[model samples]
Target: MARKIPFFIQIILIPLLIAAILLVELKHPFPKFRLAALVLVFALIVDVAILARGKTRNLMVVLASLVFGLSLAEGAAGAITPRSVVKIDRGWSVRQPIMGWGPEKAGTYHAQMIDPSDNSIIYETNYTFDSDLLRHTVSADSGPAIVFFGDSFTFGDGVKNEETLPQDFADLTGGKQHVLNLALTGYSPQQFLHEMETSRFDKVIGPDPKLFVFLTAAWHAERTSCKAYWTAHAPLYALEDGRVVFKGDCNEGASLWWREWLGNSALYSYLIEPWRHKVKHNDVELYVSVLEAAVKMAKEKYGAPTIIPYLRMPKEYLQGTGFTNDSIMQRLSDSGAIVIDASLQKEEAAGAQISIRIDGHPTPYANRVRAAQIKAAIDEKLPGVLLADAK
Candidate 1:
């Protein structure tokens, strides 16, 4: 007769076995690492069970263990896109386009090549804006300054430098202003605040003429807490002695956080993005939170009244889309900043022209329209400032 095990031993071992399998299945702590740990625990549990039963199925246990381990190994690697298949250059943001899942030539821009088969961004740019950060510095003689801040839309992805909104805004103001596009791609409100704190625009553009125009999008109001952008990358600038310092290397804190949070989870790179992008707009509070913070910051720091220009999708794109512009308008009204509702233009001939492309970024035509809208809004909101500068 086989020896009976204590009830306590059975309870302990069985639960551990179950936990190991469940952890492996749930892909905890980067999946593959959990699987390896699970396999070892499971093998030990099976061995103890076999010995307790005095069974001759030891050969079967060994075979099962081998099969399980092999399956785990294959799953780990196969679940992710091969790094070799992707060729992202180490400095550009993912917003800059890649050609066929690879880096484009120096001048040409392409969007992230998401694999249609799996919806994974097989390749992404490193989002290093060292050069752009450098360009933010201006001479005292560089004339009046306006700092432009936002996300990919503000960064001018599909358009050239001259055709971008900031450039057009600069031109519209007739060389009276030097607009700095401090808007990094993929920057949410929290990151934008961090950029503001670190970049020390106060030091760069001192006193009153330093206006800040925050061209925020409707989507980013819900994205303020996306710390993931800073986790894997080095900071473009570090705040030192109330001035910006170019660190020229990744921060240790950021690197460690990414390694700990992300680890080798293939699902993180393979699945999370498409899942995240498709998430519907439901959190109105989060959007409000970001808007309030932006308004507070603008009121306190810059003292220059904030101007928010309404962004509109091409009319054709809005058809059949289950979206309501009312909430956005409401949010803008509540923010207490000047809102330029350029979307409600009755005559296409009345406002400046914009891009006809449904999905592509704002065209040069759109930039001019946006600039004109800003001009009108500024005149209405801050009576003396804009018009006085215009004269």
Candidate 2:
């Protein structure tokens, strides 16, 4: 007679074996204890079947063990699949490639090159708008200053520190203004409003800033509704009493963190996004609402001059792309902010041109032109403030 299997072994083995299968899908690693457990369970099942004289039971046991074992091993391998980790700084974590604008104009291949402008190389502030910074930028600040807000274009994606629009403004004005570029990459207007309310730039400088300059590109209004934009880019939140609460996961690489680093391959987007809007919600309306709210908040709560500089593209260039609508322009005008349409105005006959050859962002030369535009607007809209500061 074959040896009898222990009752305890059967109970433990059955559940563990089942669990192992489930864990395989999760791709969790297996420790040595699990391997030994599997071996013992298989041996016990075979022995028990033989002792009971269960015909073909041994075959069944052997097949089950082999299948389960292979699955577990595969899961273990997946679990061990290397993950790239980025160290996050105080009050925020910027997951590169996670929530960023899809790859460059050319395209990415098997070798996914991180955008040179991304923070993976340089630890810039808005590269990844983590929870801490997001919370603080909108919160109350103490002093008078200039708060500059918007998406990547305002965040200085391709440009360096001193070359950003805000920096250019500060430099041109002789640094009299405390200019904070609160813009974040892949930022929706809602996110910008959140940053405005939560992060208190005023505290660092003074009370409500003298001016609130918001720079916007045409595409930001549409891309705001993207699910990948929401998931990978948005701040963290947890369910609290059936309500969502911002937990602000400041830790770099927590096990609970669930974010995809390698999103849709760039090649896929090049082929797809241009053809399809690929958004779940009405981003245009949402963008309009956010802008309206921002204007209201800045005027009523902060008492600052608000400016929305519109980066206009030629109709020919925007033909294939879906950004040709005048809705955003209408919204900017309706919001009561100064609208500086760069493309509409002929390049200043006197000054150097700042247009980018390959991309939409303004070049260093272009930033100077933008600075001139802002100065011109300030002179017209807030002449008293400009004159007082000049003195």
RMSD of each: 11.2, 11.0
**Each prediction's TM-score versus the true structure:** 0.55, 0.55
Candidate 2 residue-wise lDDT at 230: 36
lDDT per residue (tens digit) for residues 1-391 in model 2: 9886676776666566566545642453543333444454555465455444455776767765884674466446435533333332332323433233222322111211133334243222223232324212222223357677776567665555567777777776666555666675566555555555665444543564678888775555454443332344453333346333444431226422432321222322334435555332244455555676677777777787678887664465445444454756777678777777754255545554554433445676677677678878888877655425542
lDDT of 1 by residue, 310-345 (tens): 665443322333444555656666866676665535
Local distance difference test values of all predictions, in order: 0.52, 0.53
User: Candidate 2: lDDT of 165?
Assistant: 73
Which residues of candidate 1, in runs, are more than 4 Å off?
Answer: 1-89, 92-141, 196-199, 227-273, 276-283, 312-325, 342-359, 387-391
Cand. 1 TM to true fold: 0.55
